[model samples]
Target: MKRLVKGFAVSLLGLSMLVGCTTQAPGTGDKAAGDKKEQITVGLAISTQSNPFFVTLKEGAEKAAQENNIKLVTVDAQDDPAKQISGIEDLIQRQVDVILVNPTDSAAVVSAIKSANHANIPVITVDRSAEGGEVVSHVASDNVEGGRMAAKYLLEKIGKQGNIVELEGIPGSSAARERGKGFHEIIDKEKGVKVVAKQPADFDRAKGMSVMENILQGNKDIKAVFAHNDEMALGALKAIQAAGLKDVVVVGFDATDDAVAAVKEGRMSATVAQKPELIGKQAVELAKKVANGEKVEKNVPVELELIKK
Candidate 1:
């Protein structure tokens, strides 16, 4: 009985040694941190899921995360810059390995990006850019080219000669800025095409409707409307119809599913198509590469298309 007790004690000691050699020390940012990692956490920040465009972008990101064996946490900023910054801060505290963000206010997100950098996590911007540094990469469509496409289509449709109004997107948004610049560069050069009214709609459908209604009250001679986004264009369409206006062409950006249907139904003249899904997918892939210490380009440009009936 004494010999058996001694043998059991010796075996127990040996087992303890083996377990200690295999187990990871309890701490943060350790090599074994990934060894026991059952799921990699990724953050997805978008403007709003209410918009069908962002819904598709969310789906693409979720699908990629699923395929790559990662857990995705998504937050909607509701087009509020403050909320966007808070959402990113929450994700960083969660210690997510990577973050994918579609900024509401590009400049506002800059500090959040720096915060993530302090945590040693990688941030990939999608659909929009942030002002300050610490961004690993950015993936988005060429908004300027999209705007140019819209202007080109409108010029062809109206023989490059018409009075038009522009319904701008939310101010301080990179998409709105670039798209507006592109459209102005084209329309400004054309002697016959005149943009008589340009107003900021905050990229809301209702605001777009109200702005269009007000513009119509003063400028009944407007022949065309260019909206920074499809949602605003849809709103403008309602206003134009209510005014009993006809033969007024309306063009929009971001060819969402609803926008495509609108085009087929003759509700909208045309839309500049952007691949939100591709943007989402590319953002995930870039995050993975950055986490793996791989280098990626600062800008990954997605193609744009002009959709017309």
Candidate 2:
């Protein structure tokens, strides 16, 4: 009985050693603090999910995170700059490896980006850019070029010599600013083309309809309408139809699903098509690179196309 007891104790000690060794092996649970991270955490601060365009962007990001075995924390700003700031603050508190921000307002989001900078966290802008920040990368479509496409198509439709109304996006947004700049660069050169009115609808479909209604009420001679986004374009379309206006060319940007459907059904004349999903995917891909201390470009522009009926 004494010999058996001693042997059992020796076997127990050997089994413990084997278990300890297994745990200490490289790539096992007992990795040291400095080992390369097995999984990365990414925080996505989206502007608003209410817009279908943004929803698609979020889905793309989520998909990429899954494929890469990354953990993603998402917060929706609901189009409020203040909310975006708070959400980013939360992300910082969570100690996420990287942040992907879609600013509600270019200038208003500067402070949020600055906070991330102070936290030593890399920030990558998606879709819209911040006016001031230490962003490692910016992924988006060239809004200026997209605007040029929309303007050229609308002008051709209206014969390049007509009074047109411009439905601008939320004031101070980078998309709104750049798109407007590209549009004016072309429309300003044409003496025959005149902008009868330009109004900001805050990128809201309901507001777009109301603003268009007001403009339509005031200007019967307006020959065409150009909205900065598909939502606004659809709103303007409803107003135009309600007012029984015809022969007025309508063009919009951001070829969202509904907008594409409208174009196919001939409700909209044309739209500048942007791949929101591709933009989101590219942003995440860059985010992973940035988190891993990889070098990337400052500005990554996704391709844009024009969709017509």
Checking candidate 1 for backbone clashes, the offending pairs are none
Per-candidate Cα RMSD to the true structure, in Å, reads 5.0, 5.5
- Per-residue C-alpha lDDT of model 1 across residues 1-309, encoded as one tens digit per residue: 999999999999999999987776566436554454556788998988877788888898888888888788998999999999899999998999889989898888888889989999888889977778588788999898888888988988899888999999888888899999999888899999899999999777899999999999998887899999998999999999999999889999888888899899998999998988878887887777776668899899998988889
lDDT of 2: 0.91
| Each prediction's TM-score versus the true structure | 0.89, 0.90
> Positional deviation of 81 in candidate 1, in angstroms?
0.6
Deviation (Å) of 216 in candidate 2: 1.1
Instruction: Name model 1 segments beyond 4 Å from true.
Output: 1-38
**lDDT of model 1 at position 237:** 94
